[model samples]
Target: MLEEKFERLRNFLLAYFNQDMESPEGALQEYIEENSEGAISTTLAQINTFLHEDLTEQVKEQFIEDNCDLYFPALELTPVEWLKQVQAELKSTLG
Candidate 1:
């Protein structure tokens, strides 16, 4: 269940970043509001928790290695760090 949620969140972010969704930020805000009780920070914390605690190290590393470039450009940070940065950026942009 948690893995599915994380995948959904990741797909949302990818769509947002890739400009494949109209009003991606708005859509994400709506998603968070509906699914997470409008608590963006709490939702992000939950995502972070799932990333770090629920996934195995190898799985996490593979995911990061496979998709980091697609999401983050010209950055050498780990996947978790990139996620933190993206979350911060989104929060500021949405607010």
Candidate 2:
């Protein structure tokens, strides 16, 4: 259940916009846990890694564009499409 709710979304959403999360990953997870009807799909262990990484200072958009390979597999869709997905997910979850 967590996997369905958190794992894929976590990878996508966290990596979706940027390696550097707008907030610490744990806080973001907790926000998801409290805010969305879906679920917190990531592990605190991984969030811990995010918290400690250099990504903490990276810009959300820059991180996404630069690491396109990490976030977008095969680069099938254009970056704009990927960004739309990113925006949609964030709006759905965080709005």
Question: How do the predictions measure up, each by TM-score?
Answer: 0.47, 0.29
Cα lDDT tens digits, model 2, 70-91, are 3344546554455454344445
The candidate scoring highest on TM-score is: 1
Cα lDDT tens digits, model 1, 1-95, are 54465665555455444444344345555555555435566656655665667667667655544532243344566566666665675566447
lDDT of 2 at 79: 45
- List the global CA lDDT of all models: 0.54, 0.43
Q: Which structure among the candidates has the greatest lDDT?
A: 1
State in Å the error of residue 34, model 1.
14
69: Cα error in model 1, Å: 6.0
